[model samples]
Target: MQVKEEKEFTIQKRRCLVVWVYSLKQLKTLKRYGLIHYVSRRMKYVVIYMNEEDIEQSEEKINGLHFVRKVERSYRPDVEMNFAEKIGTKAAYQYKEEEGFEVEEISTQIRLAENV
Candidate 1:
């Protein structure tokens, strides 16, 4: 007997994307998921999204579904850059501190809010 290994939950943001399917026949089945953003029968593709927590699991499941060709990760320049900016938010603070400004924590409270 083989046991399936599970992936650990990763800390991240939820993402939306377009999924490509092998055929229109599979489109109906995959569209059953409400998260599907849209489906293009002419192009033979579907768009869907889910929280980051479920992304890994979903990709596996979706790909395993019959006639699923691929899940396309959509690109959003603004969103990606914003995330990068969030991670680098303290960069300017360090520069200010180096310029003779006293270093201090503006807010000690840890906020997990994605929107700044």
Candidate 2:
């Protein structure tokens, strides 16, 4: 005579995209498209956080941009590291440093979405 309750998963699976752009001019375009989590001035790259599905939908368009160098998919291997850990890999950091930015003080601006 007992009823079982079902649990719901309201959280969506989101992934971080490390997008490399040749120039800051493309920032306007990216801003217009939305979904950017943090923009790093050091490497001329921005970290975009979005539901995996949404990224899949726009991947082609973003990758097609001549200004965009690459879009790296950063994922979590375990819960220990923070969100930015993926991009903090040695190779990635080296690339940023070679670009002339102080790796330790890589500047980033966080963007908040009012309507996510």
Candidate 3:
């Protein structure tokens, strides 16, 4: 009997680069740096996803381009994404209802004052 070997698939960690540009025409040049994830026409920015290992070099090269106004690294990777610990905690559900007058009561009070 022949044994079948299973191959492991690995996903590379990618980080987003937010590049603000003067014009969208030079997008071809930006493609060489990383995978273009999103391009915002209205805001004039491009979101590029690059492998974590190559991000530093790509960031410098992308920033040196003439059309690029600024390049900012996305902080998504650094942020805490785990909410499992806090999900069932008492503190998480203990939000106090804001003490404010109800709209119906306020309207009734206003009507009574007008009639007086």
Candidate 4:
């Protein structure tokens, strides 16, 4: 007869966005909490993945720290949203999502906001 033991791991089901902070101390604080696997940096934003329920609490903690910039929830496109549109009127159309002007237009809007 053979006996086997199985180890169970806790699966994280919640998703979140963590803004990247410029302070080493702040990063250390977040790392100390065993939450350092999901960090993404874009421009001045740091996107992190965590439980949705912990977003507000985590943002509050990070904001309370020094040298941290404004914290706001980051938005991601829904996977279910249909995004397979061809960009031009050609017989051999291509699914060039990036070729579309949506993101560029949005970026222009953002730049305009910065000027205001």
Candidate 5:
């Protein structure tokens, strides 16, 4: 008789795209609650939204026991683009002047998760 091997999923950390109206207070909450960290190898963009802060906080609390990695900040362009793509058709767009600056506006708000 042959035995079947069970595959295991190693989920140490999770990525969350938080959406908010932009506020320093919310950002602080995310950091204070340990809901945010630095995803160095995978990314380099810092995303700390308001709505997901609560959920991320809870996740941190739970995962703390297992010493699992929590949320992290990324500031890399590639990561930012990937994040935008993951958000579906939301993100935003930018318009640049022929010889000046650039302007950006939100195309839509598509929060994949209600909480996080």
Candidate 6:
């Protein structure tokens, strides 16, 4: 009996590109660059996810499009996401009350009007 070997699946590293366009009509042309993750119709921006290796080339191509206003790379991958060390630390959770602020009190008593 021959044993079948299972192939190992690997996750590809990807980066997000925030592309701002003058109009949404050119969305079909932008689809060739990367996978569209999100589109903000009101804000006129599109979020695209592409393999990290191809990000630079994709950014340049997308920027050349006349409809595109600007292309920005997402910094999420570079930012540290670990909060384990900060979690439960006093400084991390400390709330400081503002000083020198006073609240004026208003009397709540309502006086009934006497008949004229």
| Clash count list over all predictions | 0, 0, 0, 3, 9, 0
Tell me, by TM-score, which candidate is best: 6
**Candidate 6 TM-score over all chains jointly:** 0.69
Question: Where does the lowest 10-residue lDDT sum fall in candidate 2?
Answer: 94-103
Q: Point out the worst 10-residue segment of candidate 4 by lDDT.
A: 101-110
Task: Write candidate 6's Cα lDDT for 52-98 as tens digits.
Answer: 99998889889898999999999999989977665767665556686
Per-candidate TM-score against the hidden true structure:
0.48, 0.53, 0.68, 0.43, 0.21, 0.69
Candidate 5 per-residue C-alpha lDDT over 1-116 given as tens digits, one digit per residue, 9 for 90 to 100: 99999999964444454222222333444464444533332333334423333555654553443333343333342354455567654534544457566569869867777655
Badly placed stretches (over 4 Å) of model 4 are 1-12, 32-34, 37-45, 77-80, 84-116
lDDT of 2 by residue, 1-116 (tens): 99999999798877777889998777878764447888888779988777777877666778888999998877663356564666766556455445585447778877779744
- All candidates' lDDT scores? 0.69, 0.76, 0.90, 0.58, 0.43, 0.90
TM-score of 1: 0.48
Judge candidate 1 against the unseen true structure and give its global Cα lDDT, from 0 to 1: 0.69
Candidate 6 overall Cα lDDT vs. reference?
Answer: 0.90
Query: Each candidate's root-mean-square deviation in Å?
Result: 13.8, 20.4, 9.5, 17.6, 22.0, 9.8
Indicate the worst ten consecutive residues by lDDT in candidate 6. 92-101
Q: Give the TM-score of candidate 3.
A: 0.68
Runs of candidate 6 with Cα error greater than 4 angstroms are: 1-5, 87-116
By TM-score, highest first, what's the ranking? 6, 3, 2, 1, 4, 5
Tell me which residue pairs clash in candidate 1: none
Arranged by lDDT, best first: 3, 6, 2, 1, 4, 5
Q: Indicate whether candidate 1 or candidate 2 has the larger lDDT.
A: 2
lDDT tens digits, residues 1-116, model 4?
Answer: 89888989987655545565665445656653235555544444455566766777777876776766767564552344443454334634656667664434444334566687
RMSD of 4: 17.6
